[model samples]
Target: MRAISTSGSGLVDVDVPEPQLRPHDLLVQVEAVSVNPVDVKIAASAGDERRILGFDAAGTVVRAGPEVTGFTVGDEVYYSGDVTRQGADAELHAVDARIAGHKPGNLSMAEAAAVPLTTITAWESLFTHFGADAGTTGTLLVVGAPGGVGSMLVQLAKQLTSLRVIGTASRPETRERVLALGGDATVDHRSLAASVKDVAPDGVDFLFSPFSEGNIETYAEIVKPFGHVVAIDDHHVDVFPLKSKSIAWHWELMFTHAIYQTPDMASQGRLLDETARLLDEGRLRTTLGTEIADFSAAGLRRAHELVADGKAVGKVVVTR
Candidate 1:
C-alpha cells in the first residue's frame, strides 16, 4: 500500500503493509484526506518510528469486520479516525465503524474530506460544551472565526440556534467571509474586548475561543456572568480570574470518545450523519479553501507548512 508517513519534521512516501482490521473496524480505500494542526503537532513530536499523520478522510468502504453494521462494501463514508490508531494518510485505512458517517451525496470526495474534524469540533463545542439550543435568544461570540472550525461554528450557530452570532476576524476579507457565512456581526480580533463590548454592552452569553491562550483575561471580561466559554485549543489559561464573574470554562476535544472507546462513541457518527444531511440540503457548506492536487509526500508537506503557519483561511485537502 502507498502511504505518506512522517519522517522527522517532514513526510515521506513509503510502501507499507496494509493495516489489520478489528472486529468493529472498516477497511476503507481512501480517496481524499485533509491536513490539520494536529498532524503538524504530532509530526513534530514523533519518534524515529514512522507515523501516519492524518485524521479527516473521505473514502469508500472495501470491507467491514464481522461486528460492523453501519456500513457495507462500496459505501461512501467520511470520518476523523481515532488518534490512538494509525491515521488515514494511505491508500487503505482501517477505521472504527462506530465513528464513521455516510458522506454527503452532493459533495465531492475532497469536499467531504474537509468536513469531519472541523465540523466535529464545532458541533461538539456549540451543542455539547456551550449547551446552545434552538430558539435560545442570546449573543454568542466566535473568536477566530475565519479558520476551519470557526467557519463551521458561524454557519451552524446561524442555521440551528437563535443566538445572535458575532465572529472575530482581524482582516477585511476574513470578516466579510464571516458575514457571508451568516454572522450577525464581525469584530476585529486585534481589539477583541472593546469590539465585543460595542456589540453587547452586558457581555456575550457564550464564547467559543479556538485561539484562547494569552487572551484569557480579555475573554473573562467580555463574557457575561455565568456564561459558558468553550475552547478547543490547548494552552495555559488561568480560570481563577473568571471566578468573580462566575463564568464557566469548557474544553472540547473531538478525539475523546474514540480514544477512550466510550459508551457513547457512536454519538460522533450520529453527529456527522446530521452534518451530512445539512450539507446535502444546502443548509451547511464545506470550508475547503485550498486544494492540493497531489496526494504524495511533497504535497502533504506543503499542506502541513500552510496549516502550521496559522494563517490559512479554511481547510486544506489533498485528493488522490
Candidate 2:
C-alpha cells in the first residue's frame, strides 16, 4: 500500500503493509482526503516513528469487520479516523466503522472528504459544548467565518436555530462567502469587538472562535452576560476577565471522542449521518475551498503548507 508519511524531517511517500481489519473496522479504499490544522501540527510534532498524515477522508468500503452491522462492503463512507490508528493518507485504511458516517449522497468523494472533521467540530461545539437551541432566538458571532469549521457553524446556526449569525472575516471574499452561506451579516475581524457591538448592542449571546489566540478578551467583552464561548484553537487566555460576565468557556477538540474511545464514540457516526441527510436535503453544503490534483507526498505537503499558513478559506482536499 502506498501512503504519505511524516518522517522526522518532513513528508515522504512510503510503502507500508495494509492494515488488518479489526472486529469493528472497515477496510476502506480511500477515494479522497482533506487537510486540517491537526494534520500540520502532527506533522511538525512527528518523532522518530513515522506516522500517516491525514484525518478527513471519503472512501468506499471494500471489506467490513464481523461486528460492523450498519454498513456493508461497497458502502460509501466518510470520517475523521482515530488518531491512535493509521490515518487515511493511504490507498487503503482500516477505520472503526462505529465512527464513520455514510458519505453525503449529494456530494462527490472529494467534497465529502472536506466535511467530516470540520463538521464534527462545528456540530459538537454548537450543540454539545455551547448548547445552541433551535427554539431560542439569540445572536452568535463566529470569529473565523468561511474557514472550514466556521463555514459549517454559520450554516448550521442559520438552518437549525433562530440565532442571528454574525461572522468575522478579514478578507472580502471570505466575508461575502459567510453572508452567502447564511450569516445575517459579516464583521471585520480587525475590530471584532466594535463590529460585534454594532450588530448587537447588548453583545452576542454566544461566541464561537475557531482561531481565538489573542482576541480572547475581545470575545469576552463582546459576549453577553452568562454567555458561552467555544474555541477549537489553543490560546492562553485568562479566565479572570470572563469572571465579571459569568461566562462559560469551552474548548472543542474533534479528536477527543476517538482518542479516548468514549462510550459515545459512535455519536460521531450519528452526527455524520444527520449531516449527510442535511446535505442531501440542501440544508448543508460542502466546505471544499481548495483541491489538490495529486494525492502524492508532494501534494499532501502543499496542502499542509496552505493550512499551516492559516489563510485557507475552507477545507483543502486532495483526491486519489
Candidate 3:
C-alpha cells in the first residue's frame, strides 16, 4: 500500500502494510481524497512522522465489519475521517462505518471527496452554532468566499437560506466566482472594515471564516448587534473586544463527532447523505480547484504548500 505520511521529522511517501479493520469499520479501496488546511496543519505540527494526513475521502467498500450495516461490499462511500486513526491517503483505508456516507450517483470520485470536510464545516458553523435562519431576511458575510469551506458556505446559504449572502474576496476572479455561486454582494478582505461597511449598511447576521487571524477585529466591527460569529480554523484568536457588539462567537471542527465518538457520530454520515442529495439536485457543488494523483511525498508537499500559503481558492483533491 503506497501512502503519504508525516514522520516525527518530515513528510514522506512509503509502502506500508494495509490497516487492520475493527468490528465497526469498513475496508475501503480509496479512489479519491481531498486535501484541506487541517491536513497541512497536522503534518507540520504533529511530532510523529508516522502520522497519515487526510480527512476527506471517497471510495468503494471492499470489506465491511460484522457490526456495520450502513454499507456493503462494492458500495460507494464518502467521509471526513476521524483524526485519531490513519487516513485514506493509501489505496486502501479501514474507516469507521459510523462516519461514512453513500456517495452521490452524479459525482466522480474527486468531486465526491471534496464535500465531506467543507460541507460538514459549513453545515455545523451555520446551523449548529450560529443558528442561521434559512428564511431570515438578514445578511450573511462569508469572509474569504473563495476558500474551500467559504465556497460551499455561499451555495448552502443561497440555496438553504433566504438571508442575503455577502462574500469577501481580494481578487476579481474570486468575487466573480462568489457572485456566480449566488453571493448577493462581494467585499474585499484586504480593505477590511471598509469592505464590510460598503456591502452591509445595516450589518451582517452571521460572520463565517475558516482563515486565520487579522480579520476578526474587522469582522467584529461589521456584524450587527446580536449577530453571531462562526470560525472554523484554529485561529486561537481573542474575541474579548467583540463583547461591546454583543456578538456571539462559535468554533466548528468537523472532526468533533468522530474524534469524541459522540452519541451522534452517525449524524456526520447523515449530513453527507443530505449533501449528496443536494448535489444531485443541483443545489450544491464541490469546491475542489486542484486535483492530483495518488498520495505521495511530492503530491502531499504541493498540497501543503497551497494551503500554507493561503492561495487555494477551493479544496485540492488526490485521486488514485
Candidate 4:
C-alpha cells in the first residue's frame, strides 16, 4: 500500500504493506480525501514520529469485513476516520463500518470527501452543544461562517430551522459565498459583534465560533441574556466574561466520540446517513473549495499550508 506517512521531521510518501481487515471493518479504496486543521497540527507537532495525516475520505469499498452487512464490494462511502486509527491518506484504508456512511448519490467522490469532517463538526457544535431547536424562530450567528464548517453550518441552520442565519466573513467575496450558501444575511468579521447587531437588533439567539480570534466576552455581548455559545476550536477564553450574562459556553471536539469510544460512537455514522439524504435531495451541498491531485506528500503539504494561513473558505480536497 502506498501511504503518506508523517515522520518526526516531516511527511514522507512511503509504500508499506496493506493493513488487515477486522470483522467490523470495511476496506476502502480511497479515491479522494480532504485535509482539515487537525492534519496540519499533527504534521507540525510530529516529533521523531511518523503518522498518516488525513481525516475526511470518500471512495469505494473494495472489500468488507464479515460483520459489515450494510455495505459490500464496490459501495461508495464517505467518512472521517478516527484520529487514533489509521487515516485515509493512502491507497487503501480499513475503517470501522460503524463510522462510515454511504456516499451521497449526487456528488462525485471528491465532492463527497469534503463533507464528513466539516459537517460533523458543524452539526455537533450547533445542535449537540448549543441545544439549538431547528424548528424554532430565532437568529443564529456563525463566526468564520465562510470556512468549511461554517459554510455547512449556515446551510444546515437555514434548511433545518427557522432561524435567520447571520454569517461573518471579513472579505466581501467570502460574505458573498456565505450568503449564497443560505445565510439570511452576511456580516464582516473584522467588527463581528457590532456587524451582527446591525442584522438583528435584539440579539443573536445562538453564536457559533469557528474562528481563532475574538473574545468569548464579545460573543456574549451580541447574544441575548440566555443565549447559547459554542466553539469548535481550541479557544482559551476566560469564563468570567460569560458569568455576568448567564450565557452558556460549549466546546465541541468531533474526535471526542471516536477517541473515547463513547457509548454513542455509532451516532457519527447515523448523522452521515442523514446528511447523505439531504445531499441527494439537493437540500445540503458539498463544500469542496479546491482539489489537489495525486494525494502525495507535497500536495498534502500545499493543502496544509493553505489551511494554516487561515484564509481558506470551504474545504480542500486531494485525490489519490
TM-score of each: 0.98, 0.97, 0.94, 0.95
Candidate 2 per-residue C-alpha lDDT over 121-214 given as tens digits, one digit per residue, 9 for 90 to 100:
9999889987777885888888887788889999998998898999988787887899899999988888888877787889998888776767
Top model number, lDDT: 1
Better of 2 and 3 by TM-score: 2
Candidate ranking (lDDT, best to worst): 1, 2, 4, 3
For each predicted model, how many residue pairs clash, with residues at least 3 apart or on different chains? 0, 0, 5, 3
Tens digit of per-residue lDDT, candidate 4, span 163-239: 88898877788978988998988887778768877888888888888654556667767888878888777766675
Best prediction by TM-score: 1
Model 3 lowest lDDT segment of ten: 210-219
Q: Compared with the true structure, what per-residue lDDT tens digits does model 1 show for residues 208-307?
A: 9878878888988898899999988889778887899899999999999998999999999999999999999999999998889889999898899889
Q: Per-residue alpha-carbon lDDT of model 3 for 1-320, expressed as tens digits? A: 88878887577878889899999999999888888877887887778758777889999999988999879999999998988899888879998998899999999999999889888888888778877666666888897788878888899888887888889877888888999889998987778678777777777888887664876677677888888888877767988778898999887888888878899888888888899999999889877788887467787787778778977777888887
| Model 3 misplaced stretches (Cα beyond 4 Å) | none
TM-score of 2: 0.97
So what's the TM-score on candidate 3?
0.94
**How does candidate 4 fare on TM-score?**
0.95
What local distance difference test score does each model get? 0.92, 0.90, 0.84, 0.86
lDDT of 4: 0.86
